[model samples]
Target: MSNDFYTSSILPYAAIIVKICRAYTNTQEDFEDYYQEVCLQIWRSRKNFNGQSEWSTWIYRLTLNVCLTLLKKKDRQHVASDYLPDEASEGSHVFADESLNQLYDAIKQLSEVDRGIILLYLEEKSYKEIADIIGSNTNNIGVRIKRIKERLKKLLNGKVN
Candidate 1:
């Protein structure tokens, strides 16, 4: 693709990519590093597009793979949760943001595979799509999601192990 095409089409999605990276990384520096790695992977995979899925979908999958692999390599230590816009603006008083952040904090405590599933679920990706991206089957997603939800709830309730 031409530089113009990349700049116009791909670069604009940088924020969404950053958001995804934030969910995949715990530290500010790791977030930036992972974001750059996503860029490099996208560039490397640009010509490999087979047009089987939408371009956006392909980008999502590619970046997700990059993130999950990174998580695996690091043993899924921790990752940041996204705060709602208003909560982010206000900086620490909103119940909803606190709840969501707490939930994410709990999620960060999960095994890497579980964390990957929960992260995708929070992103609202469908089971089938998640399965495709995560290399799992649809049937397994439900049970896994249920268990993960229960675990998060326990964590939020301060039932820490």
Candidate 2:
């Protein structure tokens, strides 16, 4: 991706990209890798975007797809909930509360699809927007978000099922 395009097209929405990347990656290095790949993919696939949805929505789908694909390729299992970084990673500044860290740790335990859904929901995306991004029906998105919240609560309480 050219510097101009990235600065112009991506910089504006970089926060959304970083949030999704942070949710999916454990280390600062991995997060940087995912972030770069997402930017690259968006620039490469720019032509395919025909304004079917908002630009941010397209970016969200692309970011999630890239992160999930990388996770599968790495074969890295979710880090144990008891796990905590010895020191803050590069992007740890966004989350200062210990409870937030615990919450994110639990989120990482969910399946990729669930993780994406929850991330979008937390970002305050409407059900229809989430459905469009995840390629699911709005009704399905609503049901899944409810179930995901329950599962997250269980996970946080050390009752993974």
Candidate 3:
């Protein structure tokens, strides 16, 4: 890859990869490793990108696939909950707001797939975009979102004092 590509295409999307990694990983070290893997995958696939989708869309698809593949491998279990970083702690300043806490807490209770869906939803991803990433039909994503919302309410409400 050229230095120009590094300076332009890749660096600009660095934060996008990090956001995807955080939604998928549970701790600091794992997030770093996952982020590196995503960078590698993006570089490896750049030559193959035919512009069939937007560059960002292609990268998003690639990122989700990498995370999901890692998640499905028994040997690659993401067991770094104990290594969570201080910045992402339950009491972290970034998430000091009550609704943010409730959302993340509810998210943590969801299965990995559900968590991914909810994160995409919260990111304001179109149902079509999320369905494409997850291999689900676009028409069904809205129903799934509604169900996930109901489940989130139940999950969090059950924990309240």
Candidate 4:
């Protein structure tokens, strides 16, 4: 992608991409890979956008889809790491706050779909918008968010393993 296009289009929403990628990756290396892959896919698929949704909404959908796909592929590869490296932990400034790090750790324990749902919910996307991005009904999104919130609470409270 051209620098002009990236700067003009994708740069404004870099934080959104970072948040989605961060939620899906455990290490700084994976996070950087996911971020680059998402941006590349967004540029490659730009022509496919139909303008039916707002640009930011489209970005959200695309970012989530890319992250989910990459995550599944990584799962299939079965790469395992028992501990986070010091470099990775130090580099991830996004989780600088201890509470935020705990929240993300709990989020990582959720199912993939729940991870997406909760991330979108945390971003404050409306029920209808989340349903659209997740390709689910609004009622289902509402219910899932409620359950996910409760689950997160349990996790944070040390009530669930």
Q: Which candidate leads the pack in TM-score?
A: 4
Best by lDDT: 4
lDDT of 3 by residue, 1-161 (tens): 67787677778877666666666655566667787788788888898999876787777778777876665662355466634433454554222467765566566566677777787787788998888777788878889889889888887788432
Lowest summed lDDT window (length 10), candidate 4: 82-91
Using lDDT as the yardstick, the better of models 3 and 4 is 4
The alpha-carbon deviation from the true structure for residue 80 of candidate 2, after best TM-score superposition, in angstroms, is 14
lDDT of all predictions, in order shown? Answer: 0.71, 0.85, 0.71, 0.87
Instruction: Write down the TM-score for model 2.
Output: 0.83
Model 1, residue 76: C-alpha shift (Å): 12
- For model 2, how many clashes? 0
Q: lDDT tens digits, residues 1-161, model 2?
A: 78999998899989889888888878877888999999989999999999988999999999999999997776655455534432334355346777877777777778889989999999999999999999999999999999999999898898883
For residues 1-161, write the lDDT of model 1, one tens digit per residue: 46876697579777657656666665666677888888888888888999887676677778878987886666545344442222332333212466665655566677767876787787788998778767889989988999989988887788875
Tens digits of per-residue lDDT, candidate 4, 1-161, equal 99999998999999879888888887778889999999999999999999998888899999999999998787677655634333344446456788888888888778888988999898899999999988999999999999999999999999998
Q: Tell me how candidate 1 scores on lDDT.
A: 0.71
Please give the ranking of all candidate structures by TM-score, highest first, separated by commas.
4, 2, 3, 1
Model 4 residue runs over 4 Å out of place are 79-94
Q: Point out the worst 10-residue segment of candidate 1 by lDDT.
A: 85-94
TM-score, every prediction = 0.71, 0.83, 0.73, 0.89
